[model samples]
Target: MTAARANTGIRRAPVQRRSRERVQRILDAASELIVEDGLTALSTRTIAERARVPVASLYQYFADKDEILLALVKRDTAEMDAAVDAAVGALSTVSVRTMVAATMRAFLTIYHQRPAFVVIWWRGRSNQVVYDFCRAHNKRIAADLFAFAQAMGMAQDGTVQGVVELAVEVGDRVFQLAFEHDLRGDELVIAEGIELVIGYLERHATPAGIAGVSVQGQDGPA
Candidate 1:
């Protein structure tokens, strides 16, 4: 069956377990197709066929191909957010270097686990919705980093937020380069990215004075 919904490209939120699973299968099929054949080969009919569901069932969840892609973007971004939050939370206190390493490692792990992320990120540059989502995601990450820096007494007087934004921007560029050269990511480039972020943070986020203590000198405060 052809998509009967309007061209607005909205998704019908699944409320039941079976429905959610079906929606997931549809998204999985789309992701696999995108990775195997590129975005140009993705279509609602192909996704439905791959998912072993009827075209109508696919429409029940996604209005069209774009809707399906948007849903995938949201799901992937949520997973990334969870990973980053877990990595940040694992550290009771953090230095600039430790924070950079932890966050980069978390992201690289996700990129490795979810190959679809590479497609989504690359497409984000040309897709307005995906682009906006990425920008928002970066802001949230920066905000989280800012809070972590404050908690660790490493935020500079007026540069914590900007520093965090720069770190995110630079990390994104380097990671993109790494993935461009090697799907899983280039180990050498990933290491360089970590160092690049650490250096930038060091320049902007000075250790907050606390008597014979240094944020950069230790893993964290004793």
Candidate 2:
């Protein structure tokens, strides 16, 4: 997806360097507020105050608090996606176990770096637009991972979309629970999540079908 398409929150895109800096400040202030005071306390006026800009300045970029929060959500999602993409790209050969570890680590790293992400994500779910955006984003990532598996000759010529989607769902739930219990994420839970994903992939993703070999049914590898 295009950058313009991915960023769906801002009222207007910043063009000049000064305008961009102001927008960044607004977003930074919003993030800090969410981290410090929780999502309930976030407001455009407060964000403007923290950002050292007028409320009008904030309105120039974001339509409302929800918009700012959505922008933050998109920003954090993009960073996490970039990290995962980079990690996956570096793998010359794909092993389900290795991919699971790399993806889990990459996600954890982002959570550590941006604790506010937890707050934004939790709050964003309440908004329909944000929820739909997140769902679409997840689907896109799953498709990309499926393509990666195909490129590595790991996935057979069949529909494994559900497998990738399941991986994402499992990862999100497990990671969210980890963060809910501990800021750094629970090590035991993360390890178990990795195993869960690897086991699922091993059972679902089969080698490319050849003349002599029969592909496994949905029940599992035969």
Model 2 regions more than 4 Å off: 1-7, 207-222
Q: What total of clashing residue pairs does each candidate reach?
A: 0, 0
**Mind giving the per-residue lDDT tens digits that candidate 1 earns over 1-222?**
123332233467788899988988988898898878777777899999999999998877777777777677777877877777677557655667767787889888878777777876854466666666677778888887787567666776776486688789899999888888566788998898899888877877665422212334333211
Where does candidate 1 clash, by residue pair? none
Query: For each candidate, what is the lDDT?
Result: 0.73, 0.74
TM-score of model 1 (CA atoms): 0.85
For candidate 1, the C-alpha RMSD (Å) to the true structure equals 5.1
Tens digits of lDDT, candidate 2, 1-222: 234533568888999999999999999998888888888888889999999999988888887887787788788888888888667555544566666777878878888888778766643356666677777877887787776666556666675687788888888888877777566778998889888877787776564321112212211110
What's the lDDT for residue 119 in model 2?
Answer: 67
**Residue pairs of candidate 2 with colliding backbone atoms:** none
